[model samples]
Target: MRALTGTGVLTRLALRRDRLRLPLWVVGLAALFASIGNSISGLYETDAARLENAQVRADNVVTRAFTGPAPGSSTGALTVSEGLVFTCVLVALMNILLVVRHTRQNEELGRTELVGSAAVGRHAQLTAALLVAGLANVLLIVLSTLALIGMGLPAGGSALAGLALGTVGLAFAGLTAVAAQLTESARAATGLGGLVLATTFLLRAAGDAFGNTASDDITVNPAWPSWISPLGWGQQLRPYGESRVWPLALLLLCSALSVLLAVRLSVHRDVGTGMLPARRGAVRASSAMLKPIGLVWRLQRGLVLGWMVGIAVFGAVFGGIGDQVDDLFSSEKSAQFVRDLGGEGDLVNAYFAGMMGLLAVVVSGFTVQALIRLRSDEENGPTEAVLATSVSRAHWLLAHTLIALLGTALVLAVLGLSTGLAYGAVSNDLTAALGDLLETTLAQLAPTAVLAGFALAAFGLLPRLAATVTWAAFAVCLVIGQFGTLLNLPDGLLDISPYSHLPNMPAESLTVMPIVVMVVLAGALTAVGVAGFRRRSLALGG
Candidate 1:
């Protein structure tokens, strides 16, 4: 009872802090789910059409890897099939960020100290964070279920689908709770949780991709690896297909265990510290760590390396799957759909082009991460210390911005090169694969630069709102670029995303004009941002 003291007040405080942000998340996800069903209904009017789509999914390892098992039943199930993997990833991210923000992030910022100075118990903060996260998952279930049913999906299936998503979020929420207790830094906590999530996603993808290979018939039989992933268990619920509920018990068990462990760990740890020991750095500073660029590199090198490794792994997996694209779709509908999106080119090239496009969006995230470090440094007083030295504020800001741009380019290149090498090894066209894949991947840099530039500008012009607005902008572009066509969003609106303007290289002609324009635009925005930052006072919060 003492451990639960002030839980109600703290939960209310967490909810208040996230009022606007939480609504956007719940609404955005519900909208995405609703859009999938709504759009698919029109695109797939007949059961035959849905069955054909499901057949392609069941047959194509690449499709199955990207999505999951095709329900092969009703259109609702088909919709769930197409969107489930992405939905699970998003839900997991939402919970991780939410839990870490309330728990570790609060401690990092010293807000937890102020709260704990009151009548609050030691475990109150952790309990409140879990409660807030739990409520968010519940809201996600309620809203998403209603959205699905409102789209005229089977109520039972919709409810199960929402429950599946919610339970996954809950599991991650619990995992993140443990992560917060295990790390002294919020970023480290987030990174650890993300690693777990990435592993689970890859496991799920691997299971689905290689799932049916053992059988002669191209039927859906996810491998044993799938059983180990929470996502896999959730997918096995088969929302509209088998409509199983037993697998959800695994999620419940895992979540319960995770939360229990986190609670136990919280009991052992001191406030403002973690169960994991912090690494000690050298007392002496190297010459390389003295300069602003060098210092920025030192601070950001780990983050960049982490992203590069993740991108490289993703690239290898994507490239290895290229062979599966050859005549993978026999149906005219599936082939034409690929053709329409990929241009009149080799199917494998089209697949690579789409993958590179996705990688482009992903690299933009890296860019944002690198650029946002400037804000963190500012808030934490490091920037002021650096500026007090020989370095000018503009130079300090510009150095990080440059790192963001160049680091992202390097990461993208690695992705392209890794994908090229892997795909070439499998396809036996090493030289051509290397050149084409590199070109396609580099072509995405223009849009990625635009996103980074925009984030920098937001940082300069609106310091307080920089993080929120920049991420929202990225989200908007991501939705527009990725799902605009599927959602039937207007062409004029879709054109707003810089990704929409980039040439779909390898599949189509690599035009120079649009890319050139985007680059120039990015430069202009960066210049404007730097100038604005020079004029603005520092935004430092304790």
Candidate 2:
């Protein structure tokens, strides 16, 4: 009871604080579902054509791996399944981020301390954060239901899909709450939650892929695996099939149990302490940690290594799928589409080029995150403390910035090398594929540099809103780079993404002009950021 007092008022405050952000999340999710529905309906308007396409797609291992089981016969069912699986995962991600942000992150920043001193109880804060996340899930359900129904899906099936998606979110919200209790730092909590989400997604992918195989006539019931993963349970609901709704009840039960566990953990631990004890570091600094640059490397090394490994894995998987793409495009219709999207050339090279572009986007995200870390450290007052020593502001900023740039490039190269190695193994053309991959990786440098420069400039000029501005820029770039073609956006609008200027590699000749221009822009932005940072007063902790 002491833990649950003043929950109502705190819940209201949380709601008010998240007014804009919550709505954006809900609307974005709704739009994603709606867009998917609309796209599917438009693509497969005829039942006969839809059935044929579904069968063909179901047999395609790559398609199956990406999008779970194809709907058996009905066009509507197929559309629903495709949208439900992807949207449910997206919703789960949203819930985890929201819950962790409001709970663990708030505590880490000392915001909870201010409220704790008031009439608010310990459990009240946790309860309020969970309530906020739960309410957002409810909104997600309602909006998704409306969007699906508006798409002309069966009312019951649509509602089931919405419930399933929301349930996945609720389940993860609980998981994040527990993680928040276990970890001392918000970063650790968020990272652990992300890892769980990734694991769930992989489990679901593997289950779905295994179940759909031809030799598996015994029907490897995906329901069992789906039960193993909260994400899997969402997919197992099979919205358009039987519309089983009890799985959602299971999710709710799991969520409640998780919340109870978190509460218990909270009660046991001291304020700002974690369930897992922190290990002490060595008393003396290592030789590698002596210099400022080395210190930066020490701080960022884990993240950099993680990103490299992840990108490399992605590259390998994508490369493995390349051969399958060639087989799929053997059909004239698919081949024509591929050619139109990625000029007439060796299909493998064209596909690889497009994949490399996506890799560049991911690498850009790394660059942005790395650059923004500097601003975060500065605003947190660590930068000021560091600068009070013998280090100059220019040296500190440049050291971090150079690391970001070089780190991103290294990640890109790793991706290229891993992908090339996999593709070469399949094609038995090691030299050519490796060369092509290296060239494509190099081509991405222009855009990566531009994004890094922009992030640094924002951090330097608008120290207060640097992180927000940088992320917003990255989001815009992501949209332009990914959805521009699908949305039929004009070239002028697409050109806003720096990557738009870099010619598609492996399929197109290398163009030095755009590369040179990007380099100049990067230099200019870096100079501006450095100048602004030099002039501005050093920021202190909030």
Candidate 3:
């Protein structure tokens, strides 16, 4: 009990700090779940439509890899099968980030140490972080259930689905708590948590994709691999199918173990430090390392490599699956349905084009992260150190800015190359497949540039709130680009996103006008950011 002292105050503090951010995550996820549920429900109202949907998914390795388990012959199961994995991912992300922010970020900022110096107990901060994370997951449960039920999904299934997702989320929260204790830097903590999330996701995906398909149309069985993952455990609950409670028990047990381990580790480690020691740097910096671009590269190299590997893996999977898409939709009716959904003339071309559109948003995340490093540097005192020398503010800022631009291009190009290579291998027309994928990939860079420019501009102008502003813009763009059509949002609203303006390549004629416009917008915003940084003093904190 003594170790948990002041947990309430710190918990409230976490809530206060995350007030706006927390709500946005909750509402955004709820909206996404509700929207997907509604769309699935409305699209397939009859038994025939539902079975057809299930059959297509059951046969498609790509769908199984991403979504997991074909739905049983019921509306609720269909909704669960379509939306469960993605929604669970979102919930896990929310919990992990929330825990890391309150724990490792506070320590990185020295707040944890300061609080610990007072009447606060050794475990208070971790306890508070866990408490806040638990509360958020509970809220997710309530909101998700209500949203699904409001969309006319069966109440029992909806509630079970919500509980399953929430359990997965809380489990990851506990994992993140342990990660926070293990890593000194918040970025490292978040990265560690992300790595776990990726591992579990892959485990679950591999199990689902390679798992047994029974003779009966209704049952898709996952093997032992899926049983090894927390996500897989949650999925095994099978909200609208089996509705098992035992898996939830396993998830909760894992969460409890993770939390207990974190608490024990906390007692052994010093405040503001990690259980695992950080590595020591070289005594002298190399000439190449001293250069601004090189320095920025060193800082961002880990992230770039991670993205490259992830994209390459994803590209291979997507490309491998692209070949099966045509065969899966062999029926003329299925072909027409895909074409209608894609709004493209050729089914294969349209599929590739739609994929490029989604990849654009993904690459934007990399772009934004790269650009935000400037804000991070400024806050951490590195910018001031660099600027105090012969380097001018504009030059130093532009050095990093240039890297962000070039890095975005590099990431996109790599994605294009890998995607084209794998896709061409299977598509059989190597040249045309490579050419089309590369062309679409390059065209999508316009929107990615726009996102980087926005982050850079926000960093320059709203130094303190740069992260908030940029992330909000990113979220809006993501929602508009991904869901605008389904939601039937206004053209004006959709037009606000740079992605909306890009020509749907391979499906439609390539339009140079929009690309040029997006590039100019990106350039102009970057200039604004440079000017803002030049005029303002560095906002470093003690």
Q: Name the best candidate (by lDDT).
A: 1
| Model 3 C-alpha lDDT versus the unseen true structure | 0.82
Candidate 1 lDDT over residue span 1-542, tens digit each: 88788999999999999999988887888778778777667666776666666776677676687788666547788887778878888999999999999999999999999999898988889889889888889999999999999988899999999999899999999999999999999989999999999989888888898886334232488888888998898898888877889998999888899999999998898888999999888999889878899999888888889888989977987887688764444446555555555556778777777778777787788888888777888988489899989999788988898888888888989999999998999889989999998888888888888888899888888888888888887887777886676557999998989999976678887999999999999999888888888888887421
Model 2 CA RMSD to the hidden true structure, in angstroms? 2.9
Each model's TM-score, in the order given? 0.91, 0.91, 0.94
**What ranking of all candidate models by TM-score puts the best one first?**
3, 1, 2
lDDT computed for candidate 2: 0.78
In model 2, the runs with Cα more than 4 Å from the true position are 44-49, 60-63, 80-85, 212-220, 223-226, 326-341, 344-347, 425-431, 540-542
lDDT, each prediction = 0.84, 0.78, 0.82
Clashes of each: 0, 0, 0
Q: Which stretches of candidate 3 lie over 4 Å from their true place?
A: 324-342, 540-542
Look at candidate 1 and tell me the lDDT of residue 191.
Answer: 91
